[model samples]
Target: MIKRIYPQIQGEIESGEDVLEEYSRDWSIFKINPSAVAFPKNSSDICTLVNWASLENKNGHRVSLTGRSAGTDMTGGPLNESLIVSFSRYTNKIISIGDKEATVQPGCYFRDFDKATLRKNLIYPAYPASRDLCALGGIVNNNSAGEKTLKYGKADKWVKSLRVVLSDGNEYEFRGFSGKDLEAVMARGDLFGRVHREIFRICTENKELLEKAKPKTTKNSAGYALWDVWDGRTLNLSKLIIGAQGTLGLVTEATLGLIIPPKHSRLAVIFMSDMKEIAKVVDICMKFKPESLESYDDSTLKVAMRYAPEMLSVIGAKNIVKLAYDFMPEIWRVIRHGMPKIVLLCEVAGEDEEEIKSDLDRLKANLSGEGFEVRLAATEEEAKKYWAIRRHSFALLTRHAGERKTAPFIDDVAVPYENLYQYLPALEETLKPYRKFFVYTVAGHVGDGNFHIIPLANLSDPKVRALIPRICEEVYRLTVEHGGTITAEHNDGLIRTPFLNIQYLPEVINLFEEVKRLFDPLSIFNPGKKVHGDIAYAMSHIK
Candidate 1:
């Protein structure tokens, strides 16, 4: 049937075992061989594919499709037996670039998009650290936020509009709904209109419930962001779809809102021997109103030093290194200052260089009072030296872990900023039982209380896999207690999907299910993903 439908679209469709295997898994260890993969060239091709998928099969089951770009998602969002509509190859293109917005196909790489925007002095600030490899479509689906997220916000905030394709083959550019748009939608009285109207009613009716259900953390990327759809005044479908992880609908293209780049940025890398001091340091850093504050625990630094020695020369910060050495005898201290238990990277930005410098100086003075030795970046190049450690910390773990891979199952948790001081130790205590086998290393956007808990384990071993459920229960219990989200930055894909019920109220989960049904009633769009599926299903197909 797929072979027959291949000729209907301009895009290429391959169903051979070799081709299917290529589309199977993403960056995640989870793997599920797709039945077929399609490289769609345009929206027409996607529309045709989606419409065909909506058709009933011999057993009365409609074929399903999963939208994919880059296939670099850590979660198993793109892995399925259904047809995979991959956008990373032929469909990658910037449709149009405007003064404050850029319309791009789902396949365009984030780094490529950023470079194109930079030519016009415009910037897309929500790109993840893996921007070089991640695609813009993936960012929108995951609603990713990077180092500058504190100032510019997540991918959803930057998305002005979305060109989405519904399961029934209807394509629409969703930005927001107005009186006329709502009236027009209701006038049609079709499935799309009904879904739209139902969504509006659901959002408006559950506004308070939705608000109360939100995690107290500064940022979250879990389940459906129902709270964002209705902002008390406007009804925006794009906001709801932004972080739905392609389960609700397939995004063919996205029109992203851009911002002016910061004129100057000054960075400070502070080191503290005690893990407990991290909370105090973060509290002080927050008072300065810096753009981003990141932290790296001792375990992460131990692996980082293997790569850090060569970074100074690679970034070309020779002059700054000499000046920093003169400023303090401790400059000769190793990159991690003999592997301090905790390392904090704080960055402040503005239009004036002197102002940024003054802010950095004040931050340094404040941190110094708390017994922190600060390594102020004399130039942007010098700052990259510090940023390099944080940026490539995950890579270092991957490199060092010979056979055992760093499983991010419990990574990207964000507690309320104030709760972070207490949350860290409790989390460590939670993992103590499995400490012998599971390696725990913490690093991430500490400024927002979001940290990546890298728990390394050889999943090939049944012993390690057995402890996963218990470990997860303990960790999530602590996360819930602290008013934090079980999944932060990384959307609740397959790994976290089954855990949604535990994180959110039953009523909230019902809303997520309703949203899924309204957009994908036939369940032809990434089924068994966010709203539906069990933990056993999530735990299947390990790479």
Candidate 2:
């Protein structure tokens, strides 16, 4: 049926050229064409096709599928070819809206949804940096978070219910206790007994780790829904599927919690010559528990400058203007007698302007006590202008890297805040031995103990390309030694699968596999992803 109807769908399926490119490839370093693509019209369409695929797979023939939205993922969340499925067309409805809950098609964009909710003076605030482009499905899949995560938390936090299509062609609504609404189901003796049995079995087996699982930050989207368990209240099954990466089931739709938007916001810039100062400032700023505490090192600042120079200027900074010459010339760029090596571009929002000002003063005093300079954005507009510079600088600085620079991929690793000073220098030492390459920036969400790195190196030489991973491997190993994870924001997709085992122990890694097999026994739904043993298989299927 798909083969017959698909030919005609090429035109109707994609009303605009945007679909072709938008649905094409994920951020992974692979690409391929799916056998068929879908822009589901509703839950019915998503369910029917998924049920068909599940049945086909159970009969010893598994059809591969990949679900994606907006193509904004850098961790290979989208694909060009396969039985690619999308939610772009089914975004027209808001299933139900109550005082604190909203059931929506998972494809809705945050900006659109937030604007509508604002009319009613309500908000759905699991925002990500890419919220402007990210979809609800993508947010849940990645367990995404943003600067505001300090308060609202991640995608998983907002989920109240999930509409899922299980692997065996079954669709079920497994979710949080709906007050008295679900009292009937909870009272169903046999079904309730079985559901609780499976959940208890999985939880019991994972109890040890669950105790130790303390999320890296208040937010994370690592593997599955391991963080869904909580006592004292009734069980909420939807939480388990909230961050499952499309493994156990395909989320056709979801019902989530919402909030009220903040009335006021303040943006500020704190400059430091060292990463340590940023950490110190974080400890103090965290006390205010303001909306966000964001930091970026010079490497990231370079990019943000191009993208958000107004941000840098707000703090009285111009481009460091990196020289293409050699190590000696590059040294001049940071010499203070060097440009500032690191800066924190932060946004704090609240209801009281006086409180915001007081918080800014406290922040400045702490930063100044360390003998650093501080820049504050007087209003939201000015703050955004500066942020624009910071955001764009990540890309802007590279354009003139003079064929000597390559787009730096972020190594989303994190260690305890106190350990970063030690960890960072050790990482630099390993790089120094490979003299030809340049180091990128080291900026992060210090308040949460997670940082992103752009290890910009000139990998044009074959020798340099081979050496790249070797250097990264050393850094990854060091991070593990410090009891940190190799990935913080991005999951270990095909790109990082080869190193996953080294980072995770045999037993821990094995459990990840067990979970995968249970969810996708045939291994056709996103094969060669998020597991250890499939490293070799993943290398073969790039896109």
Candidate 3:
């Protein structure tokens, strides 16, 4: 039957007795063994497989096609027991690079692309946290963004074109910017623009519904890109693909925009007396405009210092002038003045070291009058050492909490800068209600008004299900109240489905349903996910 479906393909089809653990689950979250797995060796093979799957609906089997980008999605997207299209071997062809845009297959890794584009000194900035393990397709699926996004936006912004395979077995490439301009020149609407024109007209017709759908903040990876539906009624194709989380269609390939590599970056650590002082520092740092501005709280720093002593050197402030006290020792005065209960790791990128130093000097002078130790990371090695605290924070935090057998939830709850003051106390109060449970760390791209809370709570006990969301609601409501996103970068997977309504309006969710229906009308492309439904049956059982 597999051969009949994909006659042109020359690859193994794991079925029945031959199906193994590899087909059972993805990297994390829910797990489900597919009825069969198709390992396609080429794009032609994929075309045939989807075409066959399209025909299989006649036999009453739902045609749900999903791409496996190194099988690394945390969303249980890869585990589905449907027509699992594995693109492990179809990685070939550079296609071409035109005016800083390059198109490649779904299986390509960003690091590999970095190497491929070295001569041009071009870098793809939307690097995700799992870039080392994730493929281009999965990153595209999640619309992945990471630490670098503070300067360079999410992956969606950089995408020039997308070669997506729809459920009907018809191949449609959603090309952005350039294609639309070309279409305007030719007097025929391009694929993406044409689709956008229709959607915009539909949106204007349904203006009442669209009004309710507008999000609380500028950046959101919640469900569909409902807010980005129109750019002055022009329609943005990139928004549609960014956070759909693969429920929309299968992304086979993408052409991404590139940027020039920065000449130098100066990283510094300015200690704060308390978490309350962080928001003020973050607001100030935003004025300087660094390559990256991040923070690692007491939990992360202490954990890293235990495992890696090199982390002590992350501070890169040029001056530590003691303003008030002439009697106290320099170390004591500096330490006592701004003894960061929360640490701010800020960086400034420029043409050379002198530019970095000059900016740091001015920043220090401006802030030193306010009383801060102002530690700086001078060299690349020093920068790496300081960065170890953040890079290894998850692992170190896990190791420190020995035998608890914990997992990193990696929740992102954010708000406007004004409400930063409201968070610290409320978080303290929320965690207070949960006995024996502890908060790990709270730090993130605060310059952009996004923060991550790594609350270390044991998941096994039933109390967590109730307690976590209560705390989550506290944080999310605060986020909504302050005009922020419930999710910053991480797309809504099985984990965040329940809290969707708290952050979105009734019509926004209805729009999500409309998009889901548009993409997977059969509701078989990783069903019961990115939509609120039977969580226990979908997530807990299949694993």
Best prediction by lDDT? 1
lDDT of 3 at 138: 72
TM-score of each: 0.94, 0.82, 0.84
lDDT of candidates 1 onward, in order: 0.81, 0.61, 0.64
- Local distance difference test, candidate 1: 0.81
Model 3 Cα lDDT, one tens digit per residue, 371-428: 7657666556556655656655654564566534333333666666666777666666
Q: Which regions of candidate 2 are displaced past 4 Å?
A: 1-22, 96-98, 177-196, 213-216, 230-234, 306-337, 390-410, 431-439, 455-472, 536-543
Please state the error at residue 388 of candidate 1 in Å: 1.4
What's the CA error at residue 520 for candidate 1, in Å?
A: 0.6
Enumerate clash totals for all models, in the order shown: 1, 30, 10
Root mean square deviation (Cα) for candidate 2: 5.7
Q: Please give the distance, in angstroms, between residue 74's alpha carbon in candidate 1 and its true position after superposition.
A: 1.0
Ranking by lDDT: 1, 3, 2
TM-score of 2: 0.82
Candidate 3, overall lDDT? 0.64
Candidate 2 C-alpha lDDT tens digits along 1-543: 445433222212442445555555664434555565677776566666666666667776647667776555655655534476777666446677778878877778876777777788888776666656667787776666666766677777788777777665556777656446445654564533345445555666776775565444444545554436544356665665665556566777778788776777777677677654555676767777767777767666545534343333433443322111112322454563466666676667777878878888887777678677777776555565545544444345445556555323335676665566677677667667766566566656666567666555554655655564576577778876766766666555555656766565566566667666666666656665566424445434433
